[model samples]
Every structure is written in C-alpha cells, then in structure tokens.
Target: MTPAIITKDLTKKFGDFTAVNGINFEAARGEIFGFLGPNGSGKTTTIRMMLGLLPPTAGEIQALGISVKGNQAELQQRVGYMSQRFSLYNDLTVQQNLQFYGAAYGLNKVDLKNRIQDALAMAGLEGRENAKTKDLSGGWRQRLALSTAILHRPELIFLDEPTAGVDPISRRAFWDLLYQLVADGVTVFVTTHYMDEAEHCHDLAFIQRGNIIARGSPARIKETMMDGQVLEISTSDAIKTVKVLRAAQKAGKIPLKEVELYGSLVHVVAPNIEKKINDIQAILKKAEIRTEQMAVIEASLEDVFIASMK
Candidate 1:
C-alpha cells in the first residue's frame, strides 16, 4: 500500500538560498508523523512542498498515491491543512464560518451541516457554534481552527505548529482530537518546536537545517541517541552540585549539555555516567554537599533532540 505521504529529496530554493535542502520523508497511513525542529529549520517549506502549495526545486512528493505536482487539486480535496497563526473572519459566528468553508469545499448542504456538527463536537465547541470567533480564548480559537481544518473529513491532515503558544490543557485536548482522527484512519503530519508537544506524537522526524536528522518512534529515537545513562541527583545541594560540575568540566569541554534542574533534582547527562556518578560523589564529598537521592535513568526525547541537533 502507498504511504499516506512520501517525499524523496524534496527541495525548495530561493535564488542563492535553499530553504528545504533535499529532504526525504514519509508518513504512514493512520499514523501521527511529527516534524520536530526549531524555528527557520525549513519545516514550513517542506510542508508546502508536500501540500503542493509551493513547487519543489528538486525531487518529488507523492500524497494519497498521487504526485503532488500533477494531482494537487485532488490531493487538496483529500487532505486537510491548518497553518500557524491562521486567521478566520473575526466577526463570523462559528457555524457561519463552518458553513462558508464547507460550501467552498463543495460539500452539499446536508453533508456540510453534518460534518460541521461532527467537527464541532470533536473540537469540544459544539455549543459554541454560534459564538463569534473573536470572543473565544486562545484555546477555544485553536479548537475552532482544528474544527475548520477537518470540517470536510479529509483523509490526511497537515498541521504547522498547531499548538504553539497554547496552554497545556489546550494542547492535550488537541492531541485527543488527533487520536480520534487516527482511530478513524486519518493520518496526521505536523511540525512543531515544542518538545513536550512533540513527545505526544507516535513517531517523529527531526529536521535540522532542512534535512531529516532522525526518524523513529519517540522512545526508540531517545534510546538511539543516548549510550550512557542519565543520573538524577536530588538533594539540598542540587544547584551547588551543578555549579561545581559545570565549572570543573567547562575547561575540559565536557559533553555535558547543562544541569537541567527538575524541581528538587538535577538531571546530569554525561558520558560514562558511572564514572560521573563516582566523580559527583567525590566532588560532593570535597564540597561538603548533601543530596537526598541519586540514581541513573534513561535519557528523554529532549536529550535525544539536543544531542542530534548539536
């Protein structure tokens, strides 16, 4: 069976600069594919190429079993898209907004109304269908954006940082909607900078400087990038310990990224964690520092991304 989305060496260039530099990627049917990257990593450009909104300078993109370049109209009909910072008519009621977009997509009045209801319910905005868009909060607006994007029941959805700047609750709700879509066999391809949000994806493609640096299930990706163990140090001297280690290691160009402070604990990412563990003990002994606890643990997805990006 054809992948829901496929792009081989897909590229985009602007005069002397290349935005998306020969990136290859694929998304499985009914799967959630995340494009994780920082700002200006050419994620948006790649998405545009995949959606056929912009022509690629090189390579090809196939979506829903059709070449993006040759079958853009049909592809668009089968795919839903929600862009970052998208604007809907501020004055339009939710129902009116849905109806207008539904008609534009050529949905018959009856089907359009039913889909509108379904989208609203999926977005948790059923009762607010008559509310003005501007009256909604940031979270509600995001839900509305999602509702509008999937109003036509497209086979796949492309979201560009859909949860950026939203509250955690809103982000969670959005993921719930994504899960529902997956259950219904609709694929999700999304790009986001938020690591916490990226963790929610089933699988992720890490993009760096327009290239895919890593692609796998989040857990697998995390494990692949880390060889040594992560030590979690919890004590009254967490900050003091971090300061001592960082200062001591900075001169040697230690691989330690930073002393990530987690509540009352300090997570130390290092090579030969057992050696580091012994070293930490020696330093704390010398510094007369006391810790409530210390243990080695697995690295997180954030650790993997940081290591890969570096």
Candidate 2:
C-alpha cells in the first residue's frame, strides 16, 4: 500500500536560509509518525509545505497519493491540521465553534449536526457545549481543537506540537484520542519535542536545523544511534554533578561520550562505562559531590536524540 505521506528531497527556504533542507521520509497509513526536534527545527515549515500552506523551494511532497503542490484544494479536503497554537475563537461557545468550523469544512446542515455530535462526544464536551471556549482549561481546549480538526473525517491529520502546554494527564488523554484515530485507520503525522511522547509513536524522524539526523522506530534509533551505555548517577546536586563530570571528560580524566542532566540525576554516556565506574566515583568523590547511587542503565529515546544532535 502507498504511504500516507511521502516526501523526497523536500526543501523549503526563506531568502537564503533553508528552513527545511532536502529532508525525506514516509508516514505509513494507519500509523502515528512523529517528527521530533527542538524549537526552530523546521518541523512547522515542513508541515506547512505538506499542507500546501507554504510552497517548497525544491523537491516533491505526495500526501495521500496526490502531489501536495498541484492538488492543494483536493488535499485540503482529505487532510486535517491542528496547528501549534490554539486556532479556535475564544469568545465563541463550544457548540458555536464546532458549528462554524464544520460549516467551513463544507459540511451541510444534516451531516454537520451528526458530525458535531460525534466531535462533542469524542472530545468529552457534551455538557460543555454552552460553555465559552476561553473558559475551558488548556487540556479541554486542546481536545476541542482536535475534535474540530477531524470533523471532516480526513484520511490524514497533521498535529504540530498538539500537547505543548497541557499537563501530563491531559497529554496522555490526548494521545489516547490519537490512538483511537489510528485504530480507526486514520494516519497521524505529528510533530513534538517531548521524548516520552516520541516513544509512543510507531516511527520517528529527528530533525535539527532543517536536517533529518535520525529516522526509525524509538527502539531502533536507541539500538543503532547510541554508541555506548548510559551510566545513571544520582548525586547530591545535579548541576554540580554535570559540571564535574564534564570537566573530568574535557580534562581526559574519563572517556565520556556525553554528560547530561536528566532532572535531578546525571547521566554519563560512554562505551564500556561499567569499567569506568570506579574512575567516575573517584572523580566525584574528589570534587566532594556525593554519589548517592550509580548504575549502568538502558539508554532512552532522549539519550539517543541528544547523541544524534551532537
């Protein structure tokens, strides 16, 4: 079967600066494909080109088996987009917002009514229809946005950082809705910086300054991209631990691939890290940074992502 979205050397530029440079990837039908990167990493640029909102400087974009540049009007009818920011009207009531967008998608009265009911139920906003959109919490608003985007039953959806400001519970709930969409045979092409959320995707492409450095499943990327094991160190001070380890690495005291802070803990990445545990402990001990615990742990997607960027 043809992929849901396919790009070959897809390039976009603004003046002389290339925002998305010769990037290629494919999102299979009925799957969640994640585009992972930090801010200003060409994620939004690529999405815009795919949606035909921005024309590419070069190369091709075939979404749902049609050329995005040539057949935008038809593609718009077959695809949905939930932008990075909330695009709904704040003063409008939930019912009013849905009704407006549904009509804008060209739904007639009867189908619009039925689809509005489905969207409200999907968003869990049944009783809140009369409530103003601005009155809803961040999570509620995000769900409503997703509901509005899909009111047309598009074959593919583009979500640009859909869960940015929401809480963890809400993020998880929103992902549940995405899972339902996939189960129902809708292709989801989502862009996110959250590694935990990236883990949930079936496939991913890691972008940096417009280039795709890594592309694969979460497990495959971790398995192939990381050249060493990650030694997790729980120290008295995360900042100090990273500083000391980084100094030691720079001064040739330890053969470290990367020293990074993960919340309150420090992770040291290197080949055969188990053999250098004593050296690591000794350096921290000399620096008066107490090592509460040290263990060689599995590398996470974030670890692989950081490694790839370096």
Candidate 3:
C-alpha cells in the first residue's frame, strides 16, 4: 500500500532561523505514527507543512496518494486535525457547534443530525448535547474537541499533544478512541510529551534539533537504548551518591550511559550492571554511606529520550 503521508527534503524557515531542517519520512496507512521531541525541536513545523496549513520553504508533500502542492482543498476533506490548544467555540451549545461544522462539511440536514448524534455518542457526551461548550470540564472539553475532529470520519487524523496536561484517566480514554480509529483503518499521526502515550503508537518518530534521530516501534526504541541495565541505589545522602556516580560514569570507572538523582536515590545506567553494583557499593562505603537498597530494572522510554536528547 502507498504510504498515507510522505515528504522529501521537507524544510521550513522563519526569516533568520530554520525551524525544520531538511527532513523526510513516510507513515503507512492505519499506523499510529508518533512525532516525539523536546520543545523547539520543529515537530510542529513539519506537521503544519504536511497538512498544508503552513507552506514549507522547500520540499514535496504527498497525502493519501495526492500531491499537497496545490491540491490541499481536495486533501483537507479526508483528514481530521486537532491542535495542542482547544479549537471549539466556547459560547455555542454542543449541538450547535457540531451542526455548524457538519453544515460546513456539506452534510444534509438529516445526515448532519445523525453525524452529530454519532459524534456525541462516541465522545461520551450523549447527554450534554444542549450544554454550552464552556460549561463542560477540561476532560469534557477534550471529548468535544475529539468529537468535532472526527465528526466527518476523516481518513487521516493529526493530533498534536491531544492529551497534554490531561489527567491519566482522561488520557487513557483518549487513547482508547485512537485505538478504535486505527481499527477502522483511520491513520493517526500524533505528537506528545508523554512517553506512555508514545508507547501506544505503532511506530515513533523521535526528532531533535530538526533531525529525525529515531523512528521505529516503541519496543525497538527502548531496546536500542538497552545497551546495558539500570540500577537504583537508595541512600540517605542523595547528593553525595549522585555526585559520585556522575563522576564515575564520566571518568570511565562506571561504564554507564547516565546517572540521575531522585531525592535520596541515584539511578545508574550501565551495561554489565551486575558486576558494577558491588563496586558501586564499595565506593559508597568509602564515602561513609549506608545503603538502604539496590536493585536492577529495565530502562524506561523516558530514560532513552533523555539520553537521546543529550
């Protein structure tokens, strides 16, 4: 199958600064492709160019087998989009908002009514059809936003941090909707700050400083970072122990990728970690420290992201 989205030498600039440097990639149909990166990494810029919302300084964009160069009008109808910020009309009733958008899409009165009801049902806002948009809570607002985006069941969806700042419960519910979409063959391209969210995608695009550093299954990303194991050392002196681990890792005494401090605990990222645990304990002992506990564990995607960003 042809990729759902494609780009080549995709680049964008803002006067003196290059927001998105030469980048290229493809997202297969029905795949939940994640765009991951730190702030100012140009993920948003690239997405805008793909959607034909922002013209790229230079490059080619293909969406659903159609060139986006000047056919954006034909392409927009088949793609759903939700931005990082809420885009619904706060003053309108839920039903009214849905109706307005439905009409804009050229749905007839009967079809529009049915589509509104379907959207409300899918978003779990069935009983709030007459409620004003502003009266709903944050989670409800999110549901409405999602409901509106998929109101037309666009073939492809672009969600930019759709769950950011949402509580874990709401985030999970939002992800569940995405799962249903993919099941129905609707491709989703999403960007998010939450690693747990990214882990749900079929594949991830990890970018930094305008570069696509990694792209693969979440499991692959985590495994690629697992050149070694990670161990946590809990002690009363977090500062001292963390300092020692950092210096050790830097000086080659510890063959670890990173050392991070969390309160009274120091996490060491290393390979052949079993052999170094006792050695680390010895070093801690020299500092007149008492260890509370030490254990080995798998590294988190967050850890890999930090290491990658470094």
Candidate 4:
C-alpha cells in the first residue's frame, strides 16, 4: 500500500536561517506517526510545509498520495489539522463552534446537523452543547478542537503538539481518541515533546537543529540508536548526583556516555555499565552520597534521543 505521507529532502529556509534541513520520512496509512523533537527543532516547520501552509525552500512532499506543491486546496478538503493553539471560538457554545466549523468545511445542512451530533458525542460533550467553549476544561477543549478538525471525516489528520499543556490523564484520553480514529482507518501525523507520547506512536522521527537525527519504530530506535546500556541509580539527591557525575565525566573521571536526572533517580549510560558500577558507587561514596540501588535498565526514548543528539 502507498504511504499516507512521504517527503524527500524536505527543507525550509527563512533567509539566512534553515528551519528544516533535508528531512525525509514516511507515515504509513492508518498508523500514528510521531514527529518527536525539542522546541525549535523544525517539527512545526515540516508540518506547515506538509499542510501547504508554508512553501518549502527545496525538496518535495506528498501527503495522502497528492503533491503538496500546488494542490493545497484539494488536499485541505481531505485532511484535518489541529494546530498547537487548539483553535476554537471561546465565546461560542460547544454546538455553535461545531456548527461553525462544519459549515466552514462546506457541509450541507443535514450533514452539518449529523456531524455536529457525532462530534459532540466524540468529544464527550453531549449535554454540554450549550456550554460556552471557554467554560470547558483544557481536556474538554482539546477534544472539542479534535472533534471540530475531523468533523469532515478526513482521511488524514495533522496534530501539532496536541497535548502540550494538558495533564497526563487528559493526554492519555486524547491518545485514546487517536487510537479510535486509527481503528476507523484515519491516519494521524503528530508532533510532541513528551517521550511517553512518542512511545505510543507506531513509528517516530527525532528532529534536532532542523534535521532528522533518527527515525524508526520505538523498539528499533532503542535497539539501533543506543550505543550503551542504561544504569539507573537510586539516590537521595538526584540533582546533586547528576551534577557530580557530569563533573566527573567532564574531568575524564568516568567513561559514562550520558548522565541525567530522572526524578529521584540518576541514569548513567555507557557501554558495559556493569563493569563500571563499582567505580560509580565509589565516586558517590567519596561525595558522601549514599547509593540506594543500582541496576542496568532498558533505555527509554528520552535516553535514545539524548544519545542520538550526542
């Protein structure tokens, strides 16, 4: 089957600066494809080019098997986009917003009525249709935005950091809705900074400095990108531990590849971490920091991302 989205050397430049530099990837049909990266990593630039909102300086993009160059209007009708801001008319009632969007998409009166109801149900706002959009919680607003974006039943949807500020629970719920869409054959292309969210995608690409550094299934990225094993160290002071370890590494005291603080734990990455565990413990002991536990653990997406960045 043809991929839902494809790009080759997709690049964007703003005069002297390059926002997206020679990126290439594909999103399969009916799958959640994640564009993972830090802020200012050109993820949004790539999305805008794919959506035909911004013209690329060079390279090509084919979305849903249609060239994105001059066929923007035609493509717009078949694709949905939920921007980072969760575009909605806050002053309008829930139903009113849906009605407006449905009409904007050129839905007929009867189709608009039916799709509004479906969107309301999908957003879990059945009884809150008359409620002003501003009165809804962030989670509710997010769902409402998604509902409006897909009111036309488009074949593909582009979501730019859809869960950025929402709480974890709400983010999970939003992803549940994404899964439901995929189950119904809709393709999802999303960009996110959350490592956990990246794990949920069927495939992902990590972008940095306007370039794609890694792209693959989560498992594949972990297996292929990680050059070292991760060793999780439980300590009373994670922040201090990270500082100390980083200092030691900078001074060539330890051969660790990466040292980062994860909540109350410190993760140290290195090739064959088991052999260096004793040295790690000795270093912490010298600093009067007690090591509660240490074990080799599976590398997380964040770990792989950091390693890839290096």
lDDT of 1 by residue, 1-310 (tens): 7999888888889998888889887788999999988788898888888888888999998898888888877887899988877667789998888887888889998899799988887888878988999998888888888888888889999999888888988888888888999999999999887787778888899988888889888888887777566788887677788787777678663456556666677888877877667667766777778867888877877767776787
lDDT tens string, model 4, 22-86? 88889999999999888898988899999999999999999889899999888989999999898
Lowest-sum lDDT 10-residue window in model 1 = 253-262
Candidate 3 regions off by >4 Å? 237-240, 250-253, 261-265
All candidates: TM-score: 0.92, 0.98, 0.93, 0.98
User: What is candidate 3's lDDT per residue for 103-192, written digit by digit as tens?
Assistant: 877789888888898898888899999999999888888888888888888999999888888899998998898898899999999999
Q: Give each model's whole-structure lDDT.
A: 0.83, 0.94, 0.86, 0.92
- Which window of 10 residues has the lowest lDDT sum in candidate 2? 66-75
Question: Which parts of model 4 are misplaced by more than 4 Å?
Answer: none
User: Could you tell me how far off, in angstroms, the CA of residue 217 lies in candidate 4 after the best superposition?
Assistant: 0.4
Residue 78 lDDT in candidate 4: 95
- Candidate numbers, best TM-score first, in rank order: 2, 4, 3, 1
User: Looking at candidate 1, what is the lDDT of residue 43?
Assistant: 87
